[model samples]
Target: MNTMTLWHITPAEFAVLAFAALLVGFSKTAVSGANTVSLAIFAAVLPARESTGVLLPILIVGDVLAVLTYRRHAHWPTLWRLFPAVGAGVVLGTVFLLWADDEIVRTSIGAILLLMAAVTVWRRRTAEKEEDPDEVTTRAGRAKARSYGVLGGFTTMVANAGGPVMSMYLLSAGFRKLGFLGTSAFFFLIVNVSKVPFSAGLGLIDGPSLLLDAALAVFVVPGALLGKWAVNRINQRLFEQLVIAATVVGGVQLLVR
Candidate 1:
């Protein structure tokens, strides 16, 4: 977990991962769906399965920074409704991880990311016609939450690709920008922390990954600071479009990589 223990990466790969970590923090605070760029970069820089393990800790650091900054605006009811389905989905993802080969993992994850990115774009276009405040109390709303939550949990557990799924869900539910970020921050911090045990159990995380995570964690601070500064200046609609665009690009990279 120190400088001496860190190995298995070139200077270039380390630089790439560090920049990806910065994107993790920036995506957490400024753009809701842009973390797919970091996900694709991590998967590109490391072994596909190992990348998921390495990136989890760095994501938690970003999540922590996000929650600290936006805790007050979180909509807890939506979080509460999503937890059960998400937990089930996480367990399913763990099962898949334990049995799948590296190729299977890569192809499945790549496909899922691409599909989710497409879905996010479609939802953004249709969001204007959806009802306001699609809370999860009603049966229809609960079904919607369950669907998105399960997808979010599985994708997140498998490839750290849940941001766009949740972004689409929240946008469809009529949350303003701050509320969306706050809820997402809380959701990911708790969920990513919970995945640690499962990841270690699957042998996906270990000493090497931890050391790598430690080295990348430092870059998150500046990324977070810049995100906090930039969020207010960016056009919210434009930012969302950029995020979806980045998600699509990342998905394609993963697919073709």
Candidate 2:
């Protein structure tokens, strides 16, 4: 693994990785679960752990663009409530990554994505029964927040797969469009940036991965711009359905691949 070099990778593989990186930007700005497609693409084309490492930087780039666009609309109280649990979860995930082999990492990421996709579907189907946003401070609501926060951090660290998990939590908490975008942008920017040290220490992000990231990073700008133009034009129900469908397909592909 240490001897792995970019020279061995085919042109087709580079194209896929570049597309995945572009999708990362579009997902961060326009759609939530869309990057799950990128996650699957990266994992399919690269070593499971290595893909996670490379994808983190690209995700952060997208996160920065999203944050810059939505910086003023964030809801900080929710972030404060979730950070402690997220930190603990990140620690746990780091330990897991250190121990797991390639196949195990692949399967675990697939399972987590599938589970989160289910939750997203169930939440949407039962939206009528969902509680008011004002109840976020209540005991049950706080518990829910912490639980999702932990899962979000853990999944993100392990697979760059936190989008669906956080999407569900925010939707459940009733964040409208701008608030949701702003909060998610800041949350992931902080979360992904905090993870750089852990990934580096683990030797997951190295010379070849960095080179690959640099190439893929350039595609994110156009994707982000496209996303911004398209976000308001799409129907909400259609967006949710597409995200759910992409997530499920990605999860199943990971398991089989």
Candidate 3:
């Protein structure tokens, strides 16, 4: 397929998508949940359903970059613990997508984005009140992992919106910056790569979508590099607030549009 002809986006739209792609890379390296904004941008610019498929390849690219940058810090046990529940959630999400139309998908994504932002805020506040925020009892940790894993899987499958959910989980579990980034990198890489066949079966991943992904993929690299440089120097609080604000605006736009 001629990608030039297949992708009917205007120059302005392409600029927007390229910016979103850059955010994807930056989010992977610097802040885990920051890409919720990228999700919103993609859904707004492309057909909401099709956007998820196109975004997936770009995400995998970011995931790979993240793994390369933080591979040694990954927590494999956590990944293994979450995978079974995540798998079950993915199946459930597939069923949901099979039944939902474009409008439904769009609205669901908007709602999920808003919910995730709210959840992230709540998690942070609650963690601050705890005596030992990083220490979870064995049973509690397992239950929490299962809950977050399933939700992460569902959101990722439906809207490519799992970043916030997983972010909250890792933060609650008390991971340092590098460990959080590393575990998340591997988790998304495995999960997103696995979603390819499902997305393809749903007709979300096709020749044209792949073509669009190819065009957007290059932008992710420079963004990743920038994120690596900024990760240590950036003010975390200020950046998170911006990410949340942008996510809120995007979510509201999707809901009301």
Candidate 4:
């Protein structure tokens, strides 16, 4: 059998799929920004149009794990405050997904990522003199929070590509280790749950997708375990630097491709 009967996936492609899923699990539980690489890997390994569909269910599974692990640490008030704007953004993204071209949508997502990364880097550098990297207090915190919320909702809805966007926002907000992890867990739990309806509506999480997700999910466990161990070993400064660098690279790849 050619294996096309099994979701059109081959043994060679299966390895790539596993790697991508492992990254998703790892990023979800650990880095939060590394999922972009997973996304890129999926899109590259599968047809771009079908890739998102296949990845959605796997992401939902990972989201469940992340929420469970970090449930106690979330900042619920912040989550509520961001919900309305995020909801609006999701609606907008659904509308776009319904009517937009695939390449256009992907390219736009890339550009947005690039722009967001640039802004994040600029803010960090310009604030170096007066800013305490660990201090969460800042004049622009609220405004930044709101902007990040809207952007996060939009990008995630459009591409499942909002991790870095929110990561930067939270980092800028000075959320330390547990808070950062918890806030992210809650944020994604809500966001991913919300996307289920959207993904179903878009036919991105049907039978084939679910099967693919199941096969790929096996890799997530190890990745998440690895991430949990890795996080404790890395400090805040190093973490932020890695995140920024990852975002920049992800953005560039999306744009350049």
Candidate 5:
């Protein structure tokens, strides 16, 4: 594959990428999972494999903004428990990417997004019936964290599509809006930053890709600020609904495209 320079992107493609970058920022601050749409958009607008690389830096920028905004509300114990499993999953995903082609990457991401959406819906329904929804002390709870951690790391490594997976886990664990945003903010910031070396090693992060990222990054700032303003007005139920709806839409778009 050739290095993707700024000149390679037409004006229309730049418009689409800019919009996707804005969504990246908005998803970070308001609806944590909603950036699946941005993922799909980027994949559609660029090469599927290359898109993941381009999207990573934008996501990291959003992660920084999110940490600055919601850092105080993070759940440290939960993050600690999940990191080891997530690291393993990242390794698995990296191995998978070593040989996978563009079609495989795109299909896997689409399928993962759809499956996560379904699981989240089911989990939410079952969570209402649990005796202690907020506790993660049971054997089942520990297993669930490991499960989500692995899946989150894998999807994120492959397609930058881990947001919905973590969102599902947090919601199922009974987090409120602030806690959800804050915890996820820290989780993604740390995880996305950690992936930088791996992505660079894979030749996914390079000069031309970074050039494109530099152009699109400015749009993220305004989108994040807008998200900060909007998040305050959005109720919890509506927030969760938007996240799920975005995930489904992104999945369908990726599959059909």
Candidate 6:
């Protein structure tokens, strides 16, 4: 295990950390995985290496709540189908992180977000009536699924920012509200769970991180409640739009910094 010094975080910094954790909890459960923004905020406010370590445990707590809330709605077939490809991408990402610089990672994430955003716009403009299941399953769906799976896995493993990638895919797939939440919840449960060992191996999980996590757990409750309210009050179209907007902003921030 790598030895790390525990920086003496001030009360103000601890408050910032708690606020970020709150956003993460809300994003995880209510906003369809925009917690990447919270991750970025945490990273910006702390050491990048330590940020990843500190945030993982907080995320797990949020994830448990999300799974509990959305378990019945998951599309297991989609989750299972994406796993092999996503796992491959995760392996590739972990290897890349072993040597890559922060700028490179940030730039890659920005490019991906732009690509996904462009695809989403193009589909919105040109897509005809939704293709029937038979049409979907034949050629286009499989190819799209494979592409999204690979992208999601790589982006998530590297930066915890796969929310936008998967959001675009799920949006284009034309899932209803419940299905979207369910699919996302299940997908991330697996992806995040898989990341634990790799994170540990990469020295992103350690004692100080656990201490930070413990401090932030208290904020998750209010975030979850707020998320519940947001999900119920926001119409589907607006909700999705907000998610896209948040993702775009977060992606741009990552790229710029």
Compared with the true structure, all predictions reach lDDT values of 0.82, 0.82, 0.81, 0.77, 0.88, 0.78
Give the distance in Å from residue 249's predicted Cα in candidate 1 to where it truly belongs: 2.1
Error of 5 at 34 (Å): 1.4
**What's the TM-score of each model vs. the native?**
0.92, 0.93, 0.87, 0.90, 0.95, 0.93
- The order by descending lDDT is 5, 2, 1, 3, 6, 4
Model 5 residue pairs with clashes:
none
lDDT of 4: 0.77
Q: What is the lDDT for 203 in model 6?
A: 85
Model with the higher TM-score, candidate 1 or 5: 5
Candidate 6 vs. true structure, TM-score: 0.93
Report the lDDT tens digits of candidate 5 across residue range 113-194.
7888898788778765633434658898889899989999998999888898888788777778898999999999999999
How do the residues 21-46 of candidate 2 rate in per-residue lDDT, one tens digit apiece? 88988888888768988988887787
Worst 10 residues of 3 by lDDT: 128-137
Worst 10 residues of 2 by lDDT: 1-10
Top candidate, metric lDDT = 5
Cα deviation of 105, candidate 2, in Å: 1.8
Whose TM-score is higher: candidate 1's or candidate 3's?
A: 1
Of candidates 6 and 5, the better by TM-score = 5
Pairs that collide, model 3: none
Worst lDDT window (10 residues) for model 4? Answer: 128-137
Give the number of the best model, judged by TM-score: 5
Tally clashes: model 3: 0
